[model samples]
Target: MSKLTKYLKITKGVRVLDLACGRGRHSIYLSTLGYKVTGADLSENSIAYAKKFENKNLTFMVHDMTQPTGKDFDTILNLFTSFGYFEKEEDNLNTLKSIKKDLKPGGRAVIDFMNVHFVSKGLVREEVKVVDKIEFHIKRWIKNGFLYKNIRFKIEDENYDFTETVKMITLEHFQKYATKSGLEIIDTFGNYNLDRFYEKCSERLIVIFK
Candidate 1:
């Protein structure tokens, strides 16, 4: 996050929007650095939890990723793989457009997304785990270039299933969406260390746009 703030040229008194922020971790941290911070998330519980940190320079609210915010900000952060949850590609693109719309002129958007190529390379077929008396049987695979996960859990004889699918959106895809949204790609980093990205070797694909 420090690296991200530096890249975005965030300084004291700047307004920052933590889009899809979960529990306001980054928002609260940014506010401590004297930046006005607002965290928006789809989860009501997360928003409620985040409100505990609210103060003069910090706030949180429920927000949908596809919708534009009423205010613009000097920096917008979508961190920790907080994107690509939608079922449709268009929905994902709209989220990018909303981020572009919510930024002030010359403002930067920092998006932290998974390095799909690397994940696909290390794809785990199946596994089992027991945590807190619950057993989880997990399976992962790639189909049509999209990663899918299905976790079957059993707790005290009760079973449940969870499904997740995220499209393998590459940097090229990002460039396409950014161009369509009237934004320009400025930089791309591989991980928190700020290394240059390698599609096959990088652990993450952190992108910056303006």
Candidate 2:
């Protein structure tokens, strides 16, 4: 668990939009906290799963963040390093600009991303996990400004592999993009504890902007 949800407080009646809300983890939590929430992702499977738990205040949509959004939102969340999946830096910037345009007056955003400085400093090369009779090995690294990870899983006689890559957008890069997109950076949190960011101490970057 990333624990990023602990730092959020969505006030009542606010319309919150969560981009790339995989599995609806944060969406459900925000709905329970009084915000009218919408979980949008490109994955229809995720939307289908989200529909299973729908309430009057909660809705799910199939939205590709790389494209334009028609609905305005009071608060938008791009959590868990979800911003950098775009293949290019400008593409990522465009997404932020779109978010700015879709947000209502005084609306805010919670952009949660990996701490690039820390990831660059302590690159994890290998990791292993066991899940429900499955054993998985993950190889991760930073190559050419992109974070790459390969997951190999074997459960009984079944085997699966997945490769994912993300462009590394640093704190400075995000601040510049936000400014360029007309969003003001209000505060930055280092972790779930809401501590002030330290150059080498923070594990993640959580920015609140409007």
The backbone clash count of each candidate, in order, is: 0, 0
In the range 1-210, model 2's lDDT, one tens digit per residue, is 234444445567879898899989989988887779999998999899998988988999999886758888988898888878876778888888888888998888888888888888898799998888577899998889899999999766888899999988778888898889999898898877778876676998888888
Tens-digit lDDT track for model 1 on 1-210? 787777667899989999998998889989999999999999999999999989999999999989898898999989988888787789888998998899999989988999998998898889998888777899998888688899999767788999998888899999999988999998999999999999999999999999
- The ten-residue window of minimal lDDT in model 2 covers 1-10
Model 1 accuracy (lDDT, Cα): 0.90
TM-score of each: 0.95, 0.91
Alpha-carbon RMSD, candidate 1: 1.3
lDDT of 2 at 108: 83
Give all candidates' CA lDDT scores: 0.90, 0.84
